[model samples]
Target: MSLADSPIRHPDTASRPLMTRRGWWLVGMNILIPGSAQVLAGDRRLGRFGLGATLVLWVVLVAAIVTWFAAPTVIYTIASNSVALWVVALGLVFYGVLWLVLTLDTLRLVRLVRTQPSARVPIAALTVLVLVVASGGAAYGAYLATTASGFLSSVFAAGPSEPPVDGRYNILLLGADTGPDREGTRPDSMTVASIDAETGQAVLIGLPRNLEDIHFPSDSPMAAAYPNGYGTEQGCLVDVCLLNSIYTEVEQVTPELYPDAAARNSTPGIEAMRDAASGVTGLTIQYFVLIDMQGFEALIDALGGVEITVEERLPIGGDENLQNVDGWVEAGTQRMNGYTALWYARSRYSATDYDRMQRQRVLQEAILRQFTPANVLTKFQAVAEAGAETVRTDIPQSMLGYFVDLAGKTRQLPIQSVELTPETGIEPAYPDWDAVHALIQDAIATATAEPTPAESAAG
Candidate 1:
């Protein structure tokens, strides 16, 4: 029969309403199906081709599903079978694209129906292609969600453990800018995070980066190392002795190359600083997290900016020593991104590192306030991803889940921040190990004694 001479059966010609209804019903299904609509519209060739395409699409979909489940072993060649997280993100994108294509195909089919004698083959082929893509995308999206859940479960497996100290735990959170970029390598900022797991009370202690005469846990044989001192005054002397020696030694060793080696270099320099701080604080360091400035900035931005009080008026571009990256910022109760916030917290140009340390303490408090439900809801994924990239710690991967849970529960609590600097106490010319030990002992004792509920509220 000639294509023009072919009979076109209208649904109105059917004797029973059910029979006529079958055509419209088939058309509706065909809108999203491969070739069903074409068959109802009297296109046999299209119906046959559509069925074949449907079968092929289903087969491919099943194969993809199987591959998705086997992702952990396949993608990483790891022994354990695990789903890949990135696969999930890709699946979401695919689903969105597929949905758009399917929607367009439906519109095309509707347009074809407007023709006097619907040419079903063309529309049917298009519908089949759309269905195949959409169905595949949907299947992939489901697979990705499953895989991503598994990946997240693996990511936050670590939890906070009981510190050696009876009830209170000391966490050393260090922000170091000493990675690939070499942006800045000032251990200029440090936080001694003390959490009373029992009482749910927390205290963050900040220390000035340039507090002269602080103790150092040195491996240098030239410096006189004092392990223990007799009294608080003697302890101060020991710390003084150590810092003076470190400054002298760093100056002596390749003076031009190792000018700031006592503080800048990550290996022995940073490590020894940690040890010295630990010795002085008397807080058994339970956990330590070190992050570079890039990661630090990313985290602040992800958290949607932290809230800080304007302690003193800060004008931009005053200090030549800070170089160009810093000193170009005004200070106030301002919302700061990671970079700007870092500058604010690490600004040591105008005043001593002591002033910067106070800023750091205030910023930490600001962070606790900013990391609210509203903040997390708005930027949870961003913050999480940024944190994963920035932070380096000794905490095991397995306990991250516990830490996350702890963080969530205590995120809203008011942060009590304090800075131990020369302004608060005396700085000896030589290392006074005994005095430093006493200071740490008093702080820990005060922190551990469970405060009255009213006292907690007052603080």
Candidate 2:
């Protein structure tokens, strides 16, 4: 047809005023409210579908928030459910795809109204680029959620433990060693971490591994076997009554003592140790997380090692009795790899268990400080894998979200620690339970209180 004399006119090809601005407006509308752009562009059917999908998403999100606040157990149950996680992962994928399609459709509407061909090409390309980035981010988030759900399911048990009487969660942190020379895994390091539910202030009460005359709660199985105190009635040596020996002794002699615990907990020996620790510390141990010492090196390596101040030369490899130091870590503040850090925590060459206990606490604090979010994100996969392998706990997966929130609070609070040692008037051979309890209570009180100028300065 001749240019100006053509009788036929293209209805869809008509040049519209503010075409470029309208195209940009459609992009903005799609970004803010997914379907509104389609509706404004006269695509009622597609717009209705998009609006319905968005409504469903908002409803699900609101329900999750309500459930998290009202009934956290339900959220935990959902998080622990493998099928639920799979369904959520699939739903996220669908949402991502739909979002990408809607973005492209919005750009198409822009093209329909666009008068300049050159402008349309760049606008469409830019719209696709933005949608691709957003969709990619959503997909990555979904992947991380799936990985976390799986890791939680693998490491933590399903059932919940009762909270302590003082409105705090007392978790027993046990470092278990399962060497070939030993009959069974023994708790080499035992500490009760009493955490305030509201403030996240924590008090670490360290129990010396060689503490003798270990008391057992009246209701505990150990008490039933040895009413006078573990190893006291048997007339065995003090080493038989050491606090750390309770785990191996119980596992060897009475593995079936706590049948109920077997339902939610895998290690009955650790449960026995928890009771003994509870008896001595005067604080109920709600849950226990046992870290396999052999796997601990891998976990530290996964976290890219930890930085700590070494006050003495620590030995790495030695005989079964921890004698004849083959390798020594020099005394200094330095970043240690997994093997050196593990030795720094476990070494007992010329040092006693009490000294080792203090070193362990320092190593723990260093790990907490170094395992920052930036470091975690950088090596998430390795950390997740190592953590799953190293730790076995009775803490349910449902409580993880709450614990994560509590951890955020803990980062703002000071950690108070009390170690039962000879310097603190605590005799491992004849530990006074009353004095130990008072020390722990004092630490907890100090941690929960607002810091004074002197306390802040000292800290």
The model with the greatest TM-score is 2
How would you encode candidate 1's per-residue C-alpha lDDT over 1-459 as one tens digit per residue?
A: 653442333433433443334434454565456555554454557565665666666786787668645542232222112233445445556555544443444444344444334444554565556565666666665554555355344433234344447666677777765546443254546777877655546777765544444533344222234333212234432233333233223333324422333332223434444554565565666666667666788989988777676666553444645455424556456777787787777565666666777777777777765585446645655756777667656554333434544454345455565556555464633434476566655665565565646666999
Compared with the true structure, what per-residue lDDT tens digits does model 2 show for residues 1-459?
542332111224455545766777778888777887776674768878888888898899999999877866567556556667778878888878888988988877776444476677677777877798767867876786688678877887778546556779998999988656666678888888888887677788888887887778889987888788777667432246678888876677677887776787566787888899899898888888899887899888998889999998877778667676678899999999888988898887658778999999888777765676558757877878888889988887667656765665666667788899988889888888889888888888777787734568899
| Clashes in predicted model 1 | 30
RMSD of every candidate to native, in Å, equals: 10.7, 6.0
Candidate lDDT scores, in order, read 0.53, 0.78
What value of lDDT does candidate 1 attain over all alpha carbons? Answer: 0.53
Task: Specify the poorest-scoring 10-residue window by lDDT in model 1.
Answer: 72-81
